[model samples]
Target chain A: MQITSSLDEIRSIVKAAKKNNLLIGFVPTMGALHEGHLSLIRQARTENDTVVVSIFINPIQFGKNEDFAQYPRMFDTDCELLSKEGVNVVFNPKASEMYPDGFCTTVVPEHLEDKLCGKSRPGHFRGVATVVLKLFNLIQPDSAYFGQKDFQQTVVISRMAADLNLDVNIKVLPTVRDKEELALSSRNAYLSETEKKDARCLYQALIKAKDMVNAGENNAGEIKLEMEKVINNCKSARIDYLSIVNPETLEAVTEVRNGNVVALAVMIGKTRLIDNIILMVLIVCLITLA
Target chain B: MQITSSLDEIRSIVKAAKKNNLLIGFVPTMGALHEGHLSLIRQARTENDTVVVSIFINPIQFGKNEDFAQYPRMFDTDCELLSKEGVNVVFNPKASEMYPDGFCTTVVPEHLEDKLCGKSRPGHFRGVATVVLKLFNLIQPDSAYFGQKDFQQTVVISRMAADLNLDVNIKVLPTVRDKEELALSSRNAYLSETEKKDARCLYQALIKAKDMVNAGENNAGEIKLEMEKVINNCKSARIDYLSIVNPETLEAVTEVRNGNVVALAVMIGKTRLIDNIILMVLIVCLITLA
Candidate 1:
């Protein structure tokens, strides 16, 4: 696998790939690669002739108070893992390369950006959308892979690409989780053993919400109460937001239904962890009703 | 020249052109073709193997009270002019095609968008930047052309392309003018013959500003006053904005200097017209001082 830090080199490579009629798939990440990132890379690998992974710890996405400084950067290990995963190219651009002087333009999505993760971390999705768009332009990928772990992010990016009439396709994969069902994230490295255990409450709450929706509990208020109760059981976990929202619109739904997403964010000690599940109410509710 | 209204077809054609190693140049317009647009097309034809022009009357750029509905669009005449200019492809997408239902994303340039024309027309630059970006993505041009008559627009777009790391080069050609020095614009069609004659105040103001700077007038305030005087002399003209600013930053300059752009917008009867001239202060000031 070839590792490049320059934007020009990546474009040339992408241009050459296009000349040869190779289908390119891109996986954009923030470096500290784990099972979640690997899952996206694997999907890209299986789908295209060329899989390019970008490890940019985007500073603009982080709030002033967020853990940008503490964000992990394990480049050597990440590159080794990607090489083993059969990735063709690894694009690791420096902050200066991605955001040169006089970088003033930003992609802002209205309505969608003001909800979910957007409320807590302002300008986060703007950063994500801008960098992702830049990567798509640079790589000229046929399709780009994004994990469903950052559900709202996936939605925002997909909407931006569609609204902007970008040529690339956005493919979102299911969230990868550990055996304990804690959603795998690069931030997962920040947790202590005890905090890690407590973080499982996020996934547990999502499952409980799913179970309630499956059992004909349609009231969003009732499901949220039950989900919050699960998180409250973990003494170390502090609930940030527990929402049952329409996955695509990210709007809070009064009643749970098929395709609605049950999502939650919680603070386990100082580390913030998020998890979600899309309620397949049609299949499960149909089976129960019958 | 081949005219395609479907975005997908244009992308495929652009893709094929790239495959054949042809350098593509793009010129995006709102279609009532004039000398300014023709100048850009001619430049594109000379420089690129494949020149694509898009005629999209973007609704998002115009304020509710503005002339979006009345925006002149002469497709057949536009096509004839483009064919004569040797443009390879003409992309004329319907408003619905470019902005279908659920089109929610917007590209916004912060400080630059709020100044000059952006001040008078709130969402104008946002619409221009967004549609131009969509065109760049669809065509994937090697370089894109713009007329400098809309000076602030050129700055905003150039800033956007640079900030977003878009692959295409943004080339701003000098504003094309008639023998009377009136900047060519589709909006010129809206003017009555007398109003059209009154509209000459815009270019006349720009010339007066340039002449003032040439005659050793260094104060921006003084030059603006003289330019505004010229526009005020036209009975049908009302001043919208008249200022001397840095050509690149669009920030108002206190003193006129080499490279400062003297830009103005005026409403002649009901039609709004804009014009500008770059001050060559050094040559003029040196001659005056000697």
Candidate 2:
């Protein structure tokens, strides 16, 4: 795998690959690649001729009170993992290169970004949308892979691409999780050993809700009530929000439709973990009807 | 020139043209094409292998009291002009195509946008930026051109393109004016023959300011006062703003800089005319010191 720390090198490498008729697939990430990131890379590897991963901890995405300073940065391990994953290129640009001096433009995704994660963290998705666009232009990929763990982010980016007419297809793969069912996140490193085990409740609660959703119980309110019950039982967990929402619109839903997604975020100790389960059962029902 | 009301068709045409190693030069306009629009097309032809012009009367840019309804529409004449100028394609997508049933996306340009035109017309440049970005993506131009008549818009768009790292180069060509020095504008349709003659004072004032700055005048305030004097003297002209400031920063400057753009907006009868002249007097002095 080739690694470059400059924007020029990243552009040139991607440009050359593009000229050779290679299908470039990009997975943009903040450094400190975890299992969730690897899952995205694996998907990119499956669909495209080349996979290009960017590991820039976009400074714009970090809120003032967020853990930007203490955010994980395991560059050596990240490079080794990408090399082993058979990734084609890794763009690890410094902050200055990603954001040159006197840079003063922002990309804001509308409506889709104003709820969920947006309400909890203001200007968070603005930074996300802006950096995602910059990286999309730099990579000039045929497709970009994103994990469904960041549900709102995936929705916002998809909307940005459509609205801006960006020539990139966003492919959302299922969320990756540990064997215990806790959603994989880079912030999982912030949890103590005890907190780590306690974090398992987040995914367990999601699984419980999914089973309820599948068992001819389509009321979103009923699903959320069951989810809250499971999450409240965890000793180290503080429920941020357990919402059964229409994933496409990211709005709260009363009835579970075919494409509706049940997603939630919970605070296990200090680390935030999110998980989602699309009603795949309803998708099967639609296919049978068709 | 073939004109289609579908964005998808335009994209395919541009893509095919690009495959043939043709460089696209785009000029986005709100139809009613006049001498001003022709100047842009003619300049674009000189620089690119093929030129693409877009004509859509963007509703978002117009305020409640603005002339959106009264805005001229000369479609047949506009298409004939493009054919005469050798424009390869005219992407004339309808309002429904560009903005589907429930379109909810807006692009905001900060700092520069909030001054001059933006202050007078709130959400104006945001509309401009959003549509321009959408057009740029649909056309996939090697370079996009804008005239200096709308000086603030050129600055805002150029800043947005740089900040977003959009892969298209922005060319800001000088304003083409009539013999009487009235800056070419489609809104010149609003002017009576008598009113059009008086509009000449807008450029005349800018010329007076540029001449003064070249004669070793460094104080911005002093230059602005002299400019207002020239415009206020005209019978049909009303002073809206005449400010001599730093070009890059747009801040009110007390000291002279090596490169600065002197910009202004003035009311000529009912037409809101904007014009500018980039002065090189400071550069001459700085070069002498070097």
Candidate 3:
């Protein structure tokens, strides 16, 4: 695998691939790759003639008190895993290279960014959309892979891509989970052994919500209360939000229905982990012949 | 030449051209074509294998009181002009088609969109950037052409394209003017014949500013005073903003120098018009071998 830090080099390489009629697939990551990121890379490799991976921890996405300074950066190990997955080019640009001194353009999604995580973390999706667009322009990918672990992120990106009429297809894969059913995240590195175990409460709460919906309990408020209780069982866990929302719009649904998503964010010790499960109910309707 | 209003048709046409290794050049306009728009199309035709011209009178770029409804849209005549210029295609998507039901994305430039035309027309550049980006994605042009008549627009778009790392080259051609030196604009149709005669004050004021700068008058305030006097010569012209600024940053320059732009927006009766002229001073540096 070729590793490049220069934007010019990567542009030339991607252009050359395009000139040869190569179907380019891209996976954008923030380094410190885990199984979730690796799964995305593996899927990208399967789909395209050339798979390019970008590893830039975009600084604009973090808030004032966010753990941006302490976020994991295991570049060597990440490259090893990516090389194993047969990634064609690894774009590892420095922060300055990605966002030069006078960079000030932003891609903002209206309505979609006013709920859920957007309420707590203002301008987060703005940063994601901006960086994603920059990477999309550089790679000009036929398809881009994203993980469902960051559910809202995938939705935001999808909406932005569609609204902007971007040519690339956005492919979202299922979230990769650990043995404890906790969503694999790079931030999980901040968790201690006990906190790591407690982090599973997020997934457990989502499962509880899903079961309630599956059992025909439609009240969204009731489902959230039960989810909160499941999360409260863990001493280190703090419930940030437990929402049952429309999977596409991210709008709160008072009455849970099929295809509703039950997502949660909880702080387990110093690490804030998030996980979600899509509530699916198979409907059977009896047809009466007139 | 074929004219398409369907986005899907345009995308397929552009894609087929791309597959055949044709270099695409794009010219985005708001129809009502005149010499200014034709110049941009002529440049696009000269440079690329295929030239795609988009004539969309974007509604979002107009404010509540602005003349979006009354904006002249001469599609048949505009297509004739483009066809004569050897244009490969003309994309004229409807407002609903471009901004579908749930379309809610905007591209915003920070410092760049705060002055000049942006001050008078809030959210104008945001709309321009968003629509331009959408068109850029659809056309996938190797280079895009813009007339320098909309000086702030060119700066805002150039900043947005650079910040987002869009692959297309942004080529700015000189502002095409009429016999009376009035900058060509679609809004010119809104003016009465007498008001059209008075509109020459915009270019007259710009020339006055340039003359003042060339005459070793460095003070921006002094230059503006002279420009105001020149523009006031017209009975119908009302000065909106007369600014001497750095061409790239669009920031007001305290003292006039080489590569500075004197841009203005004026209200002639009910119609608004904008014009600018870049000041250039040749500098000679003496080099001696030691």
Candidate 4:
């Protein structure tokens, strides 16, 4: 329930927790807490003795013309929700605390950064990786919780942790969604009632691709085409990218398999929304006992 | 000293030490122990309850045509020397162990990586920063030691530590030298006896720049020219770069001032050596007793 903006205080608090042999779990978020973020915090609360959540609206992660200025900052409501979740601390740092003047070092994930979301928003993952690393250092958590809503982010951070030999377990929970199957994101707040209804196509498109794979349609191009058609059914929806990719590598898959992912990004009335579903080919094994 | 090649073993050992409230100090090196490395280890030993040294001749840090293959790695001798220094542990991981297949993450320091030694050996600091970060995470040292002979490297790592908010303290110790004033390096093993004597010119040139700065020479260009002349006295020495730079920024300085570093790299026969000296301006403060 303690809210702190000072990095030193957080470090000292974490240090004390460590001295007492308490397992720490962390959830890093961008402040406008949604059901997706709450799911991550709830998971962290169940798993560790100490739970720390960071609310940082990272500016560097946004493109020059992106909606950084318009990003929601509902601190009071977010803190109240976290406090109800039995969270130990909420780290709400100012922009200057996270990125002071003359901050120059960057953590870069090669090749993985040049695809999908990275293509539209250049330098986005670099900014994500850098701030995440700084937060990781400051918190020194035993494990960090992330939602699968940002699938590529989970992959990138997992790769970064493995590559750097960071002593952190990156646990990813399933994506939380509304009754309409629209993935819950803070940006969901930007949509009008009509635009929000149209945004449901993103998830619908992903489901369509998943259904195609389930029906033994292995051609990735054909699956993408069908998914695009599903998204285009919404008049206001404009497709950014429709991809069938290897889940681990994030590389485009020519022949869709059991674990391939169908991800899509669409512009719904000036608000960009992304959604994805893993293509699962069920192999039910039947056993007869004599 | 317990020598470990397994990362898990080191992690457990450090974990046990942490449980007992022991402070860990670390020194990372490229095997072939010399006075420079010992000085760092000795300092680490005095400061912390446990000292861990890693001997990794990182291949990524070397240029394509550089001496990565021929780099001296006297493991037995290095172990013997470390044991004499009261070292607690020596971590000697295989390259594959450090960088497994498909390792794609890299730590890059912008602007600073393109100057001085980086100009000749591109991607050197990136490799250094990446591996050093890996070591820091694995060892989880309270303080890590480095020799000041690699001046720009210290600056790059310090910037990375600050930028990333790494928990470990980066301690830079003075570069250890031989009787002839030649900076101690494992690569010195590559030089012939005559070439070794000639290598002394590297440090000698740095001294000449120091003397020039001390004698009221504020022009960086003029100081570099004088240092180049001293280096040229050794016919085998071919200057790779001779310049004065701000210690923190690593940018070439047009006007020298106190704490500016005069750094150089030279190709003596087939072996490339580097050395630097800090230019300090004497400021006499007159204290008048009233």
Candidate 5:
């Protein structure tokens, strides 16, 4: 395994892999590396001969008052985890390395950027889209693995990749969670003992909506009201947005279809955590480049 | 030489070329090939073992009322010219082939998109940046060629390519011109015979500014004011912008320096044309990326 901070050196590794007829897989993260991240790494390792993981806490993706400054960094621990997981290469670049001075380019996914997480955290998806694009170009991976926990992010990235005609496949893995029903996240570290328990209520709210959706209670407005009730019942929970939206479009829909995810963001104390439950099983299809 | 319209076919060509360690050069154009475009292709052929020219008249780069529909497309003539120029492959995919249904993503160069031609033609640079990015990914060239007649565009694209970490080298060929000093462009065809003669004024105005800066002139504002006078003399010509901008910053400079280009855009009759002349030879040395 190779550890490179330089973009040129990393490109050489990925380029050499392709020249030797090896398929490449990429896992891009901000590098606090929980079990959830490891899950993505394992999938990428299984799919390709060479796997590259990038840890860039992109400042562009964070809002002015957001946790960008206080964001977690466990580079040595993160490297140990990736090394143990058999990652072929790890790209841990400073903000200066990834974004030089006077960098003014950005990738935006139009209307999709105006809803869900994008509405509250403006320019969040733009940051994600831009960084993901930069990583895709830098790594030139044959395929990329993204966790479904960040549902809208996966959709936005997939659309950007396809729209830009990037010659790579995007493989979306299922959402991973903790035993307490809390969605595993790097921000989960910010939770106090009590706040951590209250965090599970977010997952509980999503589950309540999922049950209603599965039991033929399809009025989206009615279901959202009930989900909000579940989250509001908790003492420490503050609802950011408890709306049931179309899984793919990320638009709020009145009627629940067979393929919508119960998505929402709730602020438990100061830390914001998000989780979603898949309503249906999707047939996994392989996309041949041809 | 391979002529491929399908993504898979082009990917295969790139894959095979990579295996053989052949350097690939890309020339992305908007179809209607002219002398200006040929100069780029010739440079690409000289620089790399394999050359791919993508002739796509990207619709996104055109304003709502612009001539996207009436854009001259001499496909057969372009193919013959490219072949004669020794272009190894021409990837001339139809718009439908390039942009299938559900294409929703766009790439934007933030600060630069709102200036010069970007002001006159809204969403123009967005379309150009997006399609050029797509071509950059698909062709995966060792180097790409562009014309410097489109100065702001070349600057914005160079920033985008570097910021995105796309491995392809970008080379800007010096602008090719006709005997009358009109910058060579396919759109020059739209001008009437008399309008063609009037177009020479566009370049003439740039030369007047170049002369002022050459003769120990320091104030950019004064240079711009005098140049606009020359442009106003032509009754048929409408001055869009006469800017003495720092080539790197793309900002108005009150004092001219050793590194600046006096760029201008004008509308003669119904035809819009643009031209620029770098005052100091040292500006070429200051440019970090070409």
Candidate 6:
């Protein structure tokens, strides 16, 4: 695997590969390669002639009070893992290189940015959309892989690409989780052992919401209440937001239905962890149709 | 010249051309196709193997009260002109195709969009930036051309391409003018012959500013006053905005200096026309440095 930190070099490499009609897949990540990121890389590897992974923890996406300084930077390990996963190129751009002087343009998705994770972290999705779009412009990948762990992020990026008529396909894979069902996150590194155990409540809460929907409880409020109860039981857990929303629109739904997602964010001590589960109603409908 | 209205077909054509190592140049226009647009097309033809022009009068760029509905679109005449100019492809997409339902993303250059023409037309630069970026993504041109008649627009777009790390090079050609020195514009169609004659005030005002600057009057206010006087002399003309500014930033400058721009917009019988001239100090500096 080739590791590059220059934007020009990576672009030339990708352009040359593209000239030869090779399919390119990109996986953009903030470099503390966990199981979630590895899953995305693995998927990209299986599908394309070239798989490029970018590991820049975009500073613009973090709020002023967020854990940007403390965000993990295990580059050596990250590169080794990516190499093992058969990622053809690893793009590790410095912040200065990514956001050069006089960088003033931003991509803003008007509607989808005000709900779910966007509520607590203002300017977060704008930053995400801008950086992701920049990466897409640089790489010009045939397809980009994203994990469903950051559900709202996936939705925002997909919407931006479609609305802007970007000529790249956005493919989202299912969220990867630990045996305990805690959705893997780079922020998971911040958790103490006890806090890590408590973090499991997020996944449990999502499962609780899913089970309620499976049992024919269509009321969004009741499902949220039961899920909140599960999360509130963890001593170290503090609920930030527990929403049952239309997955695509990110709008709060009054009643749960097929294709809705029960997404949550919680603070396990100082660490904020997010996880979600798509409702089973869609799967049930598919089975019935089959 | 081949005319295409489908995004997918254009992408395939561009991709095939790119594979053959052809340098592509793009000129995006709202298609009344005057000499101003022809100048850009001519420059593109000289510098690239393939020149693609897109005629899209973007609705999002026009304010509700503005002349979006009345925007001149002469497709057959435009095509004839492009063919004569040796344009390889003409992309004339419908508004619905370019911005289908659920088109919600916008590219905004926050600082540059609120000055000069932006003051009179809110969200104008935002729409221009978004559509131009979309076209860049679709075409992936090696170089994109713009006319300097819309000086602030050129500044905004150049800033956006740089900030977003877009791969295409942005090239600004000089504004094309008629024998009367009136800058060619699609909106010139809205004017009656008498109004058209009155519209010469825009170019005349710019010339007045240039004469003042050449006479060593450094005060921006003084230069603007003289320019406005020339424009206000026309009985049918109404001053929209008349100011001298730093060309790159589009910020109002108290005093004219090297690289300052004199930009103005005037309304003649409900038709708005804009014109600008870069200061001679920069030209002198260039000659001295050379």
Between prediction 2 and prediction 5, the one with superior TM-score is 5
TM-score of 4: 0.97
| lDDT agreement with native, every candidate | 0.89, 0.83, 0.90, 0.90, 0.86, 0.90
Q: For candidate 3, what is the DockQ?
A: 0.80
Candidate 4 CAPRI level: high
**Number of the candidate with higher DockQ, 1 or 5:** 1
Q: How high is the DockQ of candidate 2?
A: 0.62
DockQ of each: 0.78, 0.62, 0.80, 0.86, 0.76, 0.80
Between candidates 4 and 5, the one scoring higher on lDDT is 4
Per model, the share of native interface contacts recovered reads 0.82, 0.57, 0.80, 0.86, 0.92, 0.86
Worst 10 residues of 4 chain A by lDDT: A275-284
Task: Please give the C-alpha DockQ score of model 1.
Answer: 0.78
Instruction: After superposing candidate 3 on the true structure, give the runs of residues whose Cα lies further than 4 Å from its correct spot.
Output: A288-290, B282-290
Of 1 and 3, which scores higher on DockQ?
3
Per-residue accuracy of model 6 over A24-73 as CA lDDT, tens digit each: 99999999988888888888888899999999999999999998999999
Q: Name the weakest run of 10 consecutive residues (lDDT summed) in model 5 chain B.
A: B281-290
In angstroms, give how far residue B187 of model 2 lies from its true place: 0.6
True contacts kept of 2: 0.57
| Prediction RMSDs, each to the true structure | 2.7, 2.8, 1.7, 1.8, 5.3, 2.8
Best by DockQ: 4
Question: Per-residue lDDT of A1-290 in model 2, one digit per residue for the tens?
Answer: 89888888888998788777799999999978988899889989998998999998888888898889999999999999999999999988788866777676778777766687777678889899889888988889999999888988998888888878888999998888888777788898899989988888877887887788678788888888888989899888988777777776778889887777777778877777777777754445345554
Task: Write out the backbone clash pairs for model 2.
Answer: none
Q: What lDDT tens digits, residue by residue, belong to model 4 across residues B63-82?
A: 89989988986899889999
lDDT of 4 by residue, A83-139 (tens): 998999999888897788767899998888888888898999988998899999999
Q: Is the docking of candidate 3 incorrect, acceptable, medium or high quality?
A: medium
